[model samples]
Target: MAVIENVHERVLSAPAPAVGRLIDRLGSDGDPLWPSPTWVPMRFDRPLGAGAVGGHGPVRYRVTAYEPGRRVEFTFDPKIGLRGTHTFELLERGPESCLLRHRLVATPVGAMRLLWPALIRSCHDTVLEHLLDNAERVVTGTVSRPVRYPLRARLAVAVESVRLRAVPVPEQAALLHAALPRPDLADAFSVRVPPGVSADPQAWADGIFRNPPPVVAALLRLRNALVTPLGIERGDSSAFDTVARTDREVLLGVDAAHLDFRADVLVEPDEDGTTVTLSTHATVRSRAGRAYLAVVRLFHPPVVKAMLRRAARVAVAPPGPGARPEVAVAHG
Candidate 1:
């Protein structure tokens, strides 16, 4: 038995699972031309049943029913503010294409429902378009280009091993600090923190003693060479994605183990030149993952400062688009 039923689905040339995930994830941000109200770093909460907020701070309910890479239903609750669910499902047609359906049903408190459905719909479509465009780009090989390499680093990988010398300290830190969100690390994809918890240090201290400590974040650093021999971009996370066995480790940031990580590269132009930083962090299970960051607390100020400087040096690279700047260690 269905209440208010509205059906909307799109069929793509892409596989069903892929279309489902891409569509479901694009909820408030599916339309390419419009800005998504649920951008990852800024807006949008997963687990549709999760409550969202209005501009000021009114609770919204979202209930998501999804089957990965298939279909998604995002239902918004009016009792709360912009509450809704996002679901995804994939139906394999043959070997190539699939059907993708994404729905958003909102229960607007009495009158507000009529106020903003169109605006919400616009944002949703934009994100969906972006997903298709990105998928096309990848399939067409317009993305995933190789990095610019130095004759030395390039030759060493393509030919022989190059001797390692000094560690580039200042350069690595700057790169990490830029890639990693130093100030708002806790603001990442967060689980609903019950009705009474908070983001304060004192609250955190009390939380640990009184109840269970939710996963905060795992802080870490990594370094590697991506010479032709390694067939990788220097310190690229793509380098590890091809691994066969995924390591199993508890989320407490204690023991170091093998992991699959991606490095986000962000370049900022300055009066001097350009600064590039690689965003690196732990990708443990969401629950245990938060505990994994406990290890970062061990770093002293001097150590932290040193790391930042190293990343900075890496971030501020040399001039010239074709030129491969001096090789420096890339830290997380």
Candidate 2:
């Protein structure tokens, strides 16, 4: 074999997900991304266009360096022999449009070059050209001059599945606010209200409007993560725009199926000490196919009730995995 081959970068105009799927397929056993490329057609019915529904075959590869809607890079299997890594980056061009960059690097340092020199480069070039052409058509809405049956059918299917809904800014803001995940799902906390703190719930609600802004921010982040996907802790949420942190609270659209929450806490002096009243608003939906809205109606009250109880402990006392005086359910 030889040392390392060259790195090639191809830029195509297409939706991010579409290009991404193609890259995933190319690097995997299959060819270009997605289950089908109805948006773009191959110049010829070659390897990139030919493959069964599943992965390519015995060839195996480890995918890594994935940054969704941004960059995804993966490495080919070395044990089976030849190895390479291809990365795809999706850059927004305009509304409902994006540019995709595909880079493939092949290394013959092992025994791949001598064993399959011509085979590797040919395969690599074929993939690059195919991806570029498909992307252009998908972006410009121009498929190969003469439309084919399968390609036409795929487009028809996609068209049938597409649906649109208009969301007002206020509604969008409310949705974003409610969908933020919850805290207890992240870590344990400890809360210690003064021993004589009144069990009165009214006092607790009043205290919140007077407490501080940071308290609410911290609470929102913690709860949002736990109620979100697993491992989606508050820390994870802060790393990026999973949920935007705006200068002034604004409603930015979040993918459906995502969850966000808002809470109001108030407290009043009770004979015992004080009482806390906590209220939460929740929003959730699913993300799939043409970004259509998924109507999700379920028993959300109980799930929220459990989370409020957990948050109460964190706010009143130091955070830990411990219980305090009984939290009488004045009204759960």
Candidate 3:
């Protein structure tokens, strides 16, 4: 086993007690220092104190010691094989200043020994630095220099976004359920909306339709070309009409000679974060419709997955001055 120790410290222009208060609220509902919405949040079964169990993301640990506004320590779960402890401490430097520090002492066993230096360490270092930046921003009203996510960290987040799952259409999608009482096909795919993104389903739907990826755009063009010959309507933004909408869900679809299709976009909020589900329903009206459905069924999953993933990425990104205008959804 190889032991790896890492430490990060920052001097805040605030009193030790004030800085320590932030530590006490590490996993609380309105945490001002954990750098969430961009990364997995810190959470515990109860609250922040000795014996409280929780961890961020895939890392699991239990609080072993707590000193309220001074220091807190966590011991890793043995099953993870990264045997060690990590802690946060506040040291008073002066009447109006303090030093905040975080340290990780772990011995990686088996495969983690190799994985640590290559991947985990970079992500760990980045997260900690961002935490410190958050502390500076909250206590001092600004960060001297905010930490930009490196390529590796951005890549890690992108890869993690791809881990979506198929799900039954949510109850919130009442509009879709009513529209397709017994459709020829019904399927849903869901992904967690990253922390800090808009909870409006319209925002998520715009991400899916307004600026689709190149591959998805090409596929749609080919689809339109193939279907136009058979008198089927093209699936484009202009063809879609918002049939029904609420704050949490929006239903959009198009009708054609061969079939009727609708998509339900629903945003559900939970403790972890918001989850955006895209549920699609289709009703075939003829033999040509059935043949089209057969071919589409094969490509539906991947296309929907790609579209949802792109929406998630767009939803989390910081908007610029020239950001695209949001797509409008009709009321009622």
User: Model 3 compared with the native: what TM-score?
Assistant: 0.85
- The reply for model 1, stretches above 4 Å from the true place, is 1-9, 17-64, 77-86, 135-332
Name the top TM-score candidate: 3
* Residue lDDT tens for model 2, 270-309: 3222333333433433242112112212222333334444
Cα misplacement distance, residue 44 of candidate 2 (Å)? 25
lDDT of 3 by residue, 1-332 (tens): 55788999999999888899999999998788876665777899998999999998778999999999999999999777699999999999999999999999999987788878788888888889888988887888877767667777767766653357899977779989998878898999998854555677876777787777899899999998888888777776854567889988888887777888999999888767888899999999888999999999999889988888877765554212222212232111
The local distance difference test score of model 1 is 0.32
* TM-scores for candidates 1 onward, in order: 0.30, 0.31, 0.85
Q: Whole-model Cα lDDT per candidate?
A: 0.32, 0.38, 0.81
Ranking by lDDT: 3, 2, 1
Off by over 4 Å in 3: 159-162, 193-197, 286-288, 316-332
> Model 1 residue 23 lDDT?
43
Candidate RMSDs in order: 20.6, 24.0, 4.1
In TM-score terms, candidate 1 sits at 0.30
lDDT of 2: 0.38
